[model samples]
Structure formats: C-alpha cells, structure tokens
Target: MTGPTGLGTRTITPDLARGLLLALIAVANAHLYLVERPIGYRGYPSGLTGADAVVAVVQMVLVDGRVFPLFAALVGYGVARLAERAPESVVRRRGIVLIGIGALHGLLLFPGDIIGAYGLVILLTAPALATSSSRGLLAMSGAIGVFVVLLSSGASGPQGVPTVPSIAAPTLGAFLAGHPGEWLVTTLFSALLTAPAVLVGVVIGRSRTLDEPAAHRGRLAVWAAGGLVAGVALGLPLALAVVGVWSPTGTVGGVVAAAHAAGGYAGALGLLGLMGLLGSVSWPGRGLLAAAGTWSMTLYLSQSVVFVAVLAVWAGGLGSSASLVTATLIGLATWLVGVVVAGLLARAGHRGPFELLVRRLTYPRARTSDR
Candidate 1:
C-alpha cells in the first residue's frame, strides 16, 4: 500500500474485477489443448457435424486468444499497485523471487506457462511504471503493444507504421537450447508488449477509483463504455483471423487479430468499472467479490494446478474426451470453485496455501553476510 503520496495505494481491498478474468483464463487456456475435431483419441475427433463446427467457430474467436490478453493486462495492473508502497530495490528483489517461482511453476506445470511471462514482465517493467508519467507510460505501452502485434505477427507495421525491431515467438525448449541472449530477446518482447497493461493497473491503484465506488461511479461507467468498444473493435477481428474464419496465415492479419484480442485488454480494465458499477449498487455480491480479490494469488495458482492436472488431463487427455463446449463448462466450473474456495479460505484467516509459499520464497532472506 502507498504511504503519504496517495497517488496509488489502496487497502489491498479485494475487487471482483480480476477474479473473473483469471477464471476465464483457465477455461480459455484449456481450450487450446482440449478441443479437437471429432475423431479418435490421438487424431482430431472426426465425424463432426455442422453443429460442432459452429461451436468451434465461437470458441475460437472469442474464448481462445482473448483470455491471455486479459491475464497479461492484469499483470500490468499488479506491478502498478506494488510500486506505490515499495522501493525499486524492493520491487526488483521481489521480482527475482517471482522469476524463480515462475520457473518452478513452469517446471511443475505447463510448458507454455504464464507465470514466467508475468514474472519477466515485473522484473523489467516495474521500474518504467514507477518512473514515467502515467500518460506518457500509457502512450509508450500502446506503441509497444501495437508493435508486438505488427512485428511479431509478421504483418505490415501498425497502420503501415514502420516497426524497427521485429520479435518472434519462441518455444520454451528452443529458447532454453539457444544462446543466453535468446531468452533475453524472448522476454524483451514480453516486457514491451505487457508494459501498457501494467501501467493501466498502476493508474487504477493510484486512482483508488475502484475502491471508493460512490465517488468514482460516473467515471468508471465512462471508462467501462470506452473499454467495451475497444475490446469488440480490436478483439473480434483478431479472433476471426486466428480461427481462420478470415485468412489465418498472413502477418498483417495476425497483427490485426492480435490487436483485436488486445480489445480484451481494454475490456478487462473496463470490467473493473463494470464490477464497481454493480458493487456500488449491490451489497451482497460485492462482499464476495472483495473476498475473492483478497485471495487472488491463491486462486490464481490453484487455477493453474486444476487446469493442467484435472481439467486438461481427463482420461484420453482433456481435449481427447471433451468437446470445446465441454471444456468451456469445465473451465467455468473451475472458476466458480476458485471463487468459493478463495472466499471461504480468506475468511478462515489465511491466504492461498501456494501463495503463502510464493510469499515466503519471494521475500528476501537477510544475507548471512549482511547480518
């Protein structure tokens, strides 16, 4: 929490804003591996009728790529909250531990893991978020976000805008195999792409707009409306392109789609507004949302384990047995469970078990030398 500046510290009060996004992520990420065309266990499930194709289309466009954008944007938000109360040295040391924890998360969980990405984002981007004027930082973040889509998607530069350094998506194993600089290059792109999202979080933290609902009501409503429009405008096209409803292969199309998915980034931010709108008016559900936010890290890690171990690993592999429709249901169920678990657990005078571990590890030990 922030001390005197009052720029961006909150009570660490829970908000349901990010709870939904994190939950959606489990389902969305699972869908990537689970949905297969009707066929046998190993092959794409064959014999799909037209109905199945339709389901595929909806999931592909809306759910698949959209969730990560949401998750990444939230990570940006997280960094902003921390910078208010902590020193850079503190953020940096904490980031190192997060990187280690993320590495452990990767080793134990999915190879295509997000924790590492989030950790990498913090280690590099925290300083920038701390130093830049929020508006300037936001602008820089927008430029970088656009650049990632344009350059990495192998598309024409943004609006035929020229991009100097094109970034490539690298496989973790390949990344590990490559020279030391390769990993830096990979993370460099992540830092660039995610920085804006983090800045937005910082803005929210500083604003306390989400916390004092009555005071911020009108402002949040306005922000929510703008975010929804941006998400739709940018997200739909990107999902369609990736799903091949539009041509899937071109660099330009990919960039466009990535930008579209970026809409979800906007949506998530606006969602905080939407949540505040509801909570401002409602009494019962508001408490639940706040509770969930309190145990967010626990819920977040719990999400990862459940997805990889239970949801995706169902007999014959998660996708092997389930259709996209089934997978979505599983993901939703997982999220609901997480909220309940978080709420119950938070009131029981504890954080998430895993989160406790993360905290213990992330906090530095006094060096024997220093002592």
Candidate 2:
C-alpha cells in the first residue's frame, strides 16, 4: 500500500483555513486579557458602548467559539492521515508530546492553552478514531455534541464578574500561582467541548473532503452556504445579548447559549468548506497565507508570546488599561506579522520551530527505522 501523503503533497485547503482563521483565534483571545473591565458572558468585558460594543458583537458572531473547533477538526484530520501510515502507538506518542508541550505553555505563558486538551482528546479517542466505521464516528460525534450543548447551557457567570481571573493575572507571582489549577480545569473542559468537532473532522478526512475538494465541489458548496447561514442565524441572538441589545434570562439565556455553541460547529464546517472551495484558486497573498498555515503551530504559540509580552500586567502592563478596540487591533497586527514571518520562513526552506520539535519527537530515527 502507498504510504501517507507527505507535506509536499498535502492539500492546501486545511492549511489555508488554519492560516486565515488563526487571526480570529488571536482576536478572540486578546480581549480576555483586558483586566480592568468587569467580566461578562463568554469572557468579554461588560459595560461596553460605541466601538467596543460593536467590536464585541462582531466578535461574538464571527470569531468567538468558532475558530477553535475548526482547528480541532484540522487536528483530527491530521490524526487520521497519520493513522493511515503509522502505528497507533505513534499517533498516541504525538498526542502525549502535545500534552507535555501544552502543560508547559499553560503554566508559563497562557493558561487558556488548548493544545493539551487536544492531546487529551486524541489520547482517549485514538483507538476509536483509527478503527471506527463511519457510523461509529457519527455516533461518537453525536454523543459529544450533546455534552457540548449541555455544558454550554449550564455555563453561567455573574454579570460584571470575572469567572476566570487567572488569565488576566496581575503579577508574575500571581500568574504562576494561579495558572496551574486554571490550566488543569480548562484543559479538561476544552477537551470535552471540542471532541465532537474533532470526530466530525475524522469523518471528513476519511472522505478526503478537503484534500480532494474538486471531487466534492457540490457538497462543499452546500456545506459552505448552509453552514454559514445556520451558524450566523443561530449565533445572532447571543451576539445581540452580549451587546446589550436585549437581555435573555433563565431558560431563554441557557437556550441561546446552547444554540450559539452548536452554531460554532456549523461555523467551523462552513469555514472549512469555504476553504476547500477556494483551494484551487489563486489570490493575492494566498501563498503567504498558506505558508502561515504550514507553520500554524509556531504561529499559534508566538501569538501567546506576543500577547503576554504586550498585554500581561507583569510584562507590558497594557491589559489593565487596553480597550477592546485596541486589543482587536493588536490581534490583527499580530496575525499580520506572523503571516509575514511564516512567509519568510517558507522562502528560507524552514519549518516552524514548534512543528520541527513535534516532528522530531514524533518521528525519532529509531522508531522510523523499526517501522
């Protein structure tokens, strides 16, 4: 049998999606560091008006709870590809390595790290992922979907009160003290929340949906159109509530939040389908975007580094005073810089530092020789 497709032969769609949507990840994460404001739903600061409120609404609709699922799906797709060429042990090793890296990242830099959670999910689900039938995959996804909805529905915070303050730690000592517990809890929770998307991505990868978009154009178009429409419509109520256009209470609020979380999966699918559709086309800066995607892991970690340097109180001390608008701009600028750096790296024939690390640990010479 043919071995797995190498990076040189990998499709563009997944990387392209990662490259572009990572900016949304940056934007979504940036505001969570704003320490001076009262925290509200979904970690956004409360009592906003004017540009900040508008930005909040837009973020809720387009960015929040959306990018990560898409990334989880991409990771799943990658797992599937690896399973095709390597033993299950290798896949598990990769997941383990990611968890270790994520732990360090969480404790030292950002407590909101998802890499460890992804690793946990992969470690737990690798068996099913490698051997499950399509029906089995769908069943797993359905079960996880229900869990996500229930979790989201039950999630609540006192208005104008920060639920997770460690993310905005006021001092180096405080950050070190608080992040370990915070990381542990959030990593587990994130694993549960993102599992459904990852399973669905496995199904997509099995079908080579993104890899062979030309063969699935009609289906991709439908997913792109329907998923986006449904995602936006479902997310609108929650977005409005976040902006204080209307206040939802009791059952209404729970239902709205549940719907928003569900919509995030649809949004992820829509975005992936859209990227698949765009895979064969040429555009200005497409290469640069693809390069960034290729170096996604490094870029992801770099964002946290930059955010900590510029926004953390113990570092740049801007988080205590930065407005939502300022945070969003910073996110955009960070993404732009990352893209340029990724492009330069690609031109120089270098892999992302983190990617290189993962590859080295995942495919050691002894292991490869044995295989």
Candidate 3:
C-alpha cells in the first residue's frame, strides 16, 4: 500500500476533494489583490456594484474563511495516509518541506498563504495524533477552541476589510519581488488565525472518515447536515452585513464575528462531509479533479502566479479595474487550466514538478522507484 511520500491507497475522493478546494482557494484569494475599494471581512473588497455586492454576499457566506480549513483537513488526512505506510520521521520531514515552501511563497507572492500554517500544525500535531488518546486530542482541540474564542472576543466594529494606507496592490509588489521581512509580520498573523482550523483538521484526520468515506456515509451525512445548518445560521447574517443589509456593529458585531470565527470551520467540515457523500456518486470531470488534487501543491503555487500577472500593478495592472465578475472569471479560468494541465500530467505518468521536488527533499536517499 505504500508509496514513497505519497498516498498509500491512491483514493480518488481525497484528491477529488482537493481539486474542488483549489477553486475555492482561488476565489477566496482574489479579493486580496483588489485595489478598487477598501478591504472587507478577510480581505473581501468593498464599494460594490449590484453584481459585485451579490458576489461578495455569496463568497462571504460560502467561500471566504471556509476553504482553508478544508485544505488543512486534507493536509491532516495526507499525513494520516502517509503514516499508514511510513515512519513518523517521514511525515515530519514532509511538514518541514511544506514550511519552507510556504514561507518562501508568502514572502515572494502572497502574504495570506495557509500552507505555512498547515505546515506548523503538522510539525506540532503529527506526534500527538500518532500517540495521544482520542480524548487527549479532543481536549487539546478544546483548548485551541477556547484560545480562538478569546482571540476573537474583541471584535466590536464595522465589518469590512481593514484599510492599510501604505499597503495596496503596489506594496503587494514588495511581497512578490521583495524580501521575507517585509511580509513576515502579516504572514505570522495569518498563520496564527489559521492554527485553530488546522488543529481541528488534525482531529478530523484521526476520524479516518475521509480515508474511506463510503463505509461511513451515514455518519458523514449527519455531520454534513448539522454542520451545514450551523454554518449557515451563523454565516448568513454576517454575509448580509457585508452587503450592507444588516448592521454588524457593537455587541451584535462581536457576536457575529465570533459566530463567523467558529462557523467558518463548521462550514468547512460540512463541505468535507458533503464532498465525501458525493464521492460515492458518479460524476463527470471526476478524473480531472482527482488529477488536480494529486498535483495540488504545484497548482496552488500557480494560482499566485496567475494572480500577480493579472492583478499586480507592475504586471497586467488589472487590480483596481477588475470587478467581481471579472475576478470570478479569472479564478474560474485558472482553476480550469489547473484541472486540465493536472490531468495531462497524470496521464503522462509524471508527478507534478513541485510534488516531485518535495518528495525528494522529504526522502533524499529514496529512489524514484520507491515512489
């Protein structure tokens, strides 16, 4: 069942799940590069057209903070899959590789990168998941939840992207073409905010539900339903506020933020469960998505490349001019390209270039045949 630094069983669902996740990541990230308006919740743009307002509303409710936790869940699942065939050292080494790549990625292109956060969590939690009792891990998760609650409790303000006077798509150039120190602070804050979701992902990984989702459909169904309901109940009001429907100020705002902080993760888990349920049904383009999942790292890095080229001031300079509809189209195009290219690469029997590099780093002495 083992493959060097790769999944042991080659399950289609996890990769398929990853494929869908990349699209969400693309949409979630599109807002950060926008310069036409002030930043709103998690970098979503403000001053919307009717269409943009609707897009923002949908994204806030479904896309914003939900995607990364699902990605983290997949990462934890990958670690678990690796554990089934390799030693703990192997998992740790892979985590180190991710950290290095993530750090470099954040410094060079996007400061909001979640890969680094996931890497830190892997380094911190791999051992615990391997050795701790389920109760112990649950307790640890509870502690992390409390910390998240405390960190988010101070939110009593208007809901929107924070306006940084000196920072814009141009200064984003600093991250893309400059040094690590420039973006390090932003990167650190982003990583901290992402840590709780990563820990929750680790717990889900231990469940082994995603590992063989078909066998656990009933349980996943309940989780999918409950998580979906909880997520929407907490998320909808916030979305409405972002689009100027509801007021997210004062105690109401603080409560809304807390709900969002918690509900985003719930939504992510619900999506994961839903995806697992859908994994059982036959679908078109399933193979393409599976391939994209297998090549996720390469595709993820590629997304930043596309963003910089299309949006950065020094490049295509679409930053302020690109509307939500335009951004959505760009994101869709990027995702489609990722799926197609990944499928072609998979068909050619080649590992993604970045994936191969990571495997080599993770297992330096291991031969290609081992993979």
Top lDDT: which candidate number? Answer: 2
Model 3 segments beyond 4 Å from truth? Answer: 1-8, 155-182, 369-371
Candidate 2 per-residue lDDT, tens place, 16-46, comes to 8789878888998898888767777788877
lDDT of 1 by residue, 1-371 (tens): 32222212223233465665666666555554443332221111333335554555454444444556555655555566657666786667556766666565544444445565667767776677668787777787678776665554554122211011111112334423332343344345545655556666666666776567678889879867886666666666644433335544455555665575466567666665666677567566555555676566667667667765553333235654666567667777878887877867665555556555554554445221111
- TM for every model, in the order presented, reads 0.75, 0.95, 0.90
Candidate 2: which pairs clash?
none
lDDT of 1: 0.55
Ranking by lDDT: 2, 3, 1
- 1-371: candidate 3 lDDT, tens digit per residue: 34474433477888889988889988887766676576565556655669988888788767766787678778867776676677778778887888888888777776666677777777767787678765776687667766775566565344344332222545554535544554455546555566666666666667777767789899889878887777777788778876667667777777888787777778888888888887766788887788778889999999989987887666767876788878887988998898898877775666888888887887788774323
RMSD of each: 7.5, 2.4, 2.7
Q: What stretches of model 2 exceed 4 Å from their correct place?
A: 1-6, 156-159, 366-371
Colliding residue pairs in candidate 3: 39-161, 40-160, 40-161
Error of 1 at 43 (Å): 16
Reference-based lDDT, each prediction = 0.55, 0.83, 0.73
Q: Which wins on TM-score, candidate 1 or candidate 3? A: 3
Say which prediction, candidate 1 or candidate 2, comes out ahead on lDDT: 2
Better of 2 and 3 by lDDT: 2
By TM-score, highest first, what's the ranking? 2, 3, 1
